[model samples]
Target: MITRVRSELTRYLRTETVGGALLLIAAAVALIWVNSPWGASYQTMVDTSLAIPALHLDLTLADWTKDGLLAIFFFVAGLELKREFVVGELADPRRAALPIIAAVGGVVVPAAIALAVGHGAPGMDNGWAIPVATDIAFALAVLAMTGSRIPVSARVFLLSLAVVDDLLAIILIAVLFTASLSLLWLGAAVACCVAWGLAQKYRLHTPLFYIPVALICWYALHEAGIHPTLAGVALGLLTRVRKDPGERTAPATHLEHVVQPISAGFCVPLFALFASGVPLNTAVLGSLFTDRLALAIVLGLLLGKTIGIFGVSWLAIRLGVAKRPVGLEYRDMFALSVLGAIGFTVSLLVAELALADVGAETIELAKAAVLVTSMAASVLGSALLLRRGRVHQARRDADQLPQGEGSTK
Candidate 1:
């Protein structure tokens, strides 16, 4: 059994597309089970009490998944982001411009829409940043399930857009969601982060030094009223390997090869189960349509995201600041814009923070709205992409044929 498990793990580690698909499937099953008739039992199992001696820690499974497992996901995300900036497409200014502009426009328009929709409502204004995120795992999962029929350029575009969207989400979380600031703790976190960077400069290949420093950073950031996970990003960037385009075998790739699959295959799937699965009830269903919080989230996700991503992307292409991707027309871009509307994971995370002090009813309502909007976006975007793929293939085939052959025949 152990050997079989190891073999499966090895296979998953080698392919990004396959590993991502499996994780997503696990997440989907978890979601369905969480909302099913047996959901209460599942919730109970997750919420059962447990205590850790010496550490003075006691929390439910769900809480641990959110605060603990999700931190690892964020850390991996930070690592990937750092890697991209150092050696990937983001290293080129011209190639990066379209996604950067699209990300900014994506964020701004959603926030504005949320603010407009949620205006004058108590506590709703603070949640305007909630819908600006793009859940890369879920978005990528959608594309993966649809197979290679989709263009490679579209996938690359989606990835770049998601990366920028993540950066924007982290910024919004820092600037908007923070409750209070502690300069002393913030300073400590910064110093530790700087030390980590220096350690990297000294070619500290061992992972030991980074672990302790990372814990300190996490604690300090927690004390500073910033979410503890932001420290994961900070430490990740500090320890991230910055290489020239051609650098050969290094610790960075080694670590990615070792850690990324584990994080994605295990931590991410667990997070999906824990973070996304919420018990559905009348209150949740009712709030999906009526509550100020739910309404803002739904509108921001469904309407705000589509309009923002498509509108700014179109403007960029038209203004010559960015060229349209080869083989991807405006129609395809619009479909991808709809895919950007799938805001499940981060939306739920933000919902937790936004309604932390509120009743469970409010939180449940917000969750339902997120689920609905995310599902809608995924379905609509997939249909449009599949249709566009057929069209593109037909055009390509037509272009490849010898001129006048059809008329002569």
Candidate 2:
């Protein structure tokens, strides 16, 4: 019975729909809990402090969820990214150019919109990055649910686009958020990364060796004033993605299979629970419109993402720089671009980090903006997807019908 239960649990964790549902449920719980009569208790729980003095580590429950647990999510992202670059859709420059260009447009346009709208606003310096990421799990979940009739290549396009989007977001985080630099700790982190790469090269497969090294590298990055989650990305990219002769699976694929469940089932939902507890009071709701920072985020997500992704993609195809995915028309690409605007996970992280130095009220407003915009994008994208899906479904049905049966009619 225990073995059976374990197998079922693993299956549930591996399902993207389940993972996405859990993420949405966690965020909803956070919102409701924070706005409840016992809202103060929610804040207290998030603020509860923990420390490891020997390691010079101290943080609140919220910090741990954001900075520590979320690393697992990023690690899984890095693994997907490496696999794609090595052997997936991104392996071919012809197939990769479209998503790569579209991902850049997705990032650049939203940031430009945010900067233009929020000029001189408090926290606008870094808060413009809030809409620059695409949540892979959530976006993929929505696609899986709504776009079943869409071509298989549409899913591949979205996946490749999201992977590149995440890579850009990670780069922005490392560049925009690091306020101080410690050379010694930075060197230590680099050394640990080198050791990790060597372990992969020499085929060291033991978790016992890797677990400690990963921890030390994470701590070193923290001490060096770089986000510790970058350690996850570095290690994931360094992992070997190619299989040896007689090997069952490549290390990257195997690791993704193992760690993805943990990241999706636990790490992301926990982080959402902690990071998404923004107060939705009347003032906060009003400020979502009145506050420049909030308005920038909303518009950046809704308008900028759509325009950037679709516009650049159209240009690319027209100019013969890239071709659209198989069986996906311009309208379908537009819907996919709207789906790209569902910027939940990394967007929330950026909201927190970008507004960290600002007051709590500002931070809450930013997070609320992210939640609101992401939901809007999801709804709008789903509508577009369902419409496009019906079109494709009808086409498929017609093609599958008996030959010339409707000609007389």
Tens digit per residue, CA lDDT, model 1, 1-409: 9999987786666465665566557667777888787888777877876666555557678766666666766776777677767787677777778888888888899889889888876557567877899888778777766635657888878888987898789877788778899999899989988988898787776668877888788768867878877886676666556654555655566566666777678777776676666666776777677877678889998899999989999999899998777777889888888989988777778887777777666676777788778889989988987888788788778887866686788
For candidate 2, the 10 contiguous residues with the lowest summed lDDT are 400-409
Model 2, range 98-217, lDDT digits (tens) per residue? 999999999999999999999999999899999899999999989988888889998999999999999999999999999999999999999999999999999998999889998999
Clashes of 2: 0
TM-score of each predicted structure versus truth? 0.89, 0.98
Tell me the whole-model lDDT of each prediction, alpha carbons only.
Answer: 0.77, 0.93
Off by over 4 Å in 1: 1-37, 49-58, 242-248, 281-283, 403-409
C-alpha lDDT (0 to 100) for residue 315 of candidate 2: 99
Please report the TM-score between candidate 2 and the true structure: 0.98
